[model samples]
Target: MSEDVLVVHGGTPLRGEIQVRGAKNLVSKAMVAAVLGETASTLYDVPAIRDVEIVTGLLEAHGVKVSTGPEGELVMDPANVTRAAVDEINVHAGSSRIPILFCGPLLHRLGHAFIPDLGGCKIGDRPIDFHIQALREFGAVVDKRPDGLHLSAPNGLRGIKYELEYPSVGSTEQVLLTAVLADGVTELRNAAVEPEIVDLICVLQKMGAIIKVHTDRVIEIQGVAKLSGYSHRPIPDRIEAASWGAAALATHGEIFVRGAKQADMMTFLNVYRSVGGAFSVDDSPIGGGIRFWHPGGELQPVALETDVHPGLMTDWQQPLVVALTQARGLSIVHETVYERRFGYTTELRQMGANIQLYSECLGGTPCRWGRRNFLHSAVIAGPSKLHAADLQIPDLRAGFSHLIAALAAEGTSRVYGVDRYISRGYEDFDGKLAALGARTERP
Candidate 1:
């Protein structure tokens, strides 16, 4: 099935309520936190993805008893966890950045651990250097092995103040997980405070971890001898909700993203409105939802830039850029996050969109992706008639953007890699398409 390409029929209006499952970002961290607890942690609405399976298998390898009920409820008991075998290490090799997080809990619980090489969205060289550095601050000695990473803390862990160079999500999570059971308070500065991280912190707090968040990008974690189990309802996936909203705009359809939080999506919502899109949001006390639609007016092209949380998410840039194809004028987008993200535009060009890559910053803070293969820029000339063909998904977000483009195209599109990982976040995608009046079938 990995080799099979998903064929999509274009020019279908996707309408329906797609219920997002537990976030891919949250579920993995929640799994890791379960190990920190003394009792069983049962998580509901967990998304069934390869990463989830990898984490689950890793937990089971450590002698943690994990089982799932019929409705995808996951029960994890970590009382018996001792050591993770090499066979378990093989399960998550090249799977996700998450396996590296087990280092903290494994070291605390068993005093020795081995973490396989990490894998995730291949945006760039996401080395675990920051994660290693942070863990070392907490009194861990790590050795790089040919097969995997071997870590030990025979003297036990004593927390210290640590700062991150870049707010790498995996590294930040490693700090949080490792700090929970350390000897003293650990302060993390310049942390990646993405909503997912906050959600993970909430889960830890629920488990009796003493953690405090200050406005100056500082998180203080006081070490505790033990943590009790927690049952948490994770925050909705903002990225997935943004993709659905972008799909509505690109396809010229209306969609109400149920369970979407407007608080986390303010930047995206602002950008969408700037593009002559109209959306009415229903804000809840805790987690709000949004209803997005393309306004029946002249679509305006606006300059776009990607940033961390609170700024434009780099992940949403691809799909939202597809909607620019229907706008009347040229749209400028600065991708400050990932360098290779612009590669998807070449694929869009094959389908008749006028886009040019620029080498210079085009006038902004040139991002990490700048200076490498026409980074820091893309000029999209829109209102082009999209003709579908064979499309391939290079990564997760790009895959969904490709799916949106295929859906808005004039003919049919054979999108390879839909089976690769699309189901990880999108639930009942085919059925949702069916509800949206799209003529699509699994070939």
Candidate 2:
């Protein structure tokens, strides 16, 4: 586990049970929500991913006391909230983009906030212009500095009616975190309505915030005078569940992912079934999860598109592509979410999968990247015999896809930089791989 290189013996179908905790996307935001509260907040079923660690560090630097309780519960006391030094914040945040989220809460708590140079997965250019404009609209003075961004609310934050050009989740989150404490009513048009955003609204409600979700991607938030803390359990990690399901398909194995709720994965489940994979949902009182397997038949190729929530997730596309490589015919994937998401296909092709990337939109409606010349479309022609090859970990989801390909391939494969990228999202991935009977060694 100490070594960065993982030597994986291939052609073994992974079979076993692995447990998932809270949604990595939601839990971190909930932790950030704690900063807006005057009292302490408690979050349950939190994951052990590096993003959580980064958020915890950022909170602690701002004088929030974060402590762990029994069974993955986190207790965060914002009683002594204070601004942290820029260098210290930069050092602790590493490459995570979570620190940018602190701008809203910190502006309310201490009238000023500083964000270091932000970094995240290299999938695409995730510009923070939307966030800056949203904050500016709320009456915060934003100044760009050499190191990072400095934001100050001299006249205090006042809510304003705003509309997003595109329904970006990060922009929605910024508005939510800021609007909860601003003056007057904040109306956001074309807001992101993802389940995680809904769950975050639930968290805000528990803190005495008044928010309303209207139809047609409109959300209205009425600002309040003061807020208290909240105690809540976060939603389960749907992305992790889908990743495990894809692993089962690629390796021709069976995996029972405990804590994978079917309600959160309906879209992914539909796609998994359409690909000729077999799965059954179990909702017993003694903990429930989904079991996925290959079903010992020719896998069906599919024409897929990545979109916002309620559509196929961009994060789920990569691992499914690995499984699609084993399908009997041609498979098409149109990535409408992130333009550079198909970059991982090159590594998959190196492992003997017939994957071709193109700039033109394929198999779905034209999107933002349609005429941008980004290689966002992929055509994977398969039942291509996979062979092990040395692979470098790219981003989080793509890294997991490479891991699945290595496990499904013949001979041994060496995976490097996993500890840096994959560990950012997946919790104890090596331990889970071992539990699932993957023959792996750190060297």
Where does model 1 exceed 4 Å of error? 1-3, 70-72, 283-288, 369-374
Candidate 1 all-Cα RMSD = 2.0
TM-score (C-alpha) between model 2 and the true structure: 0.99
* Model 2 residue 342 distance off true place after TM-score fit, in angstroms: 1.0
Task: Give a tens-digit lDDT track for model 1, residues 1-443.
Answer: 63457677888777665656678888888998999899999888786766688788888888989988875689999999888677767777876777888889888888988877777777766778888887887888988878887999979999889888776677789999999999999999888888889999999999999999988678999999999888877877788888989888888888877788878888988999999888998776533478888778778898888887777988889888899888999999887766667777777888888888886665457666555664658888878889998887777787888889899999989888876667656666667777777777777
lDDT for 117 (candidate 1)? 73
In model 2, pairs of residues that clash are none
Error of 1 at 185 (Å): 1.2
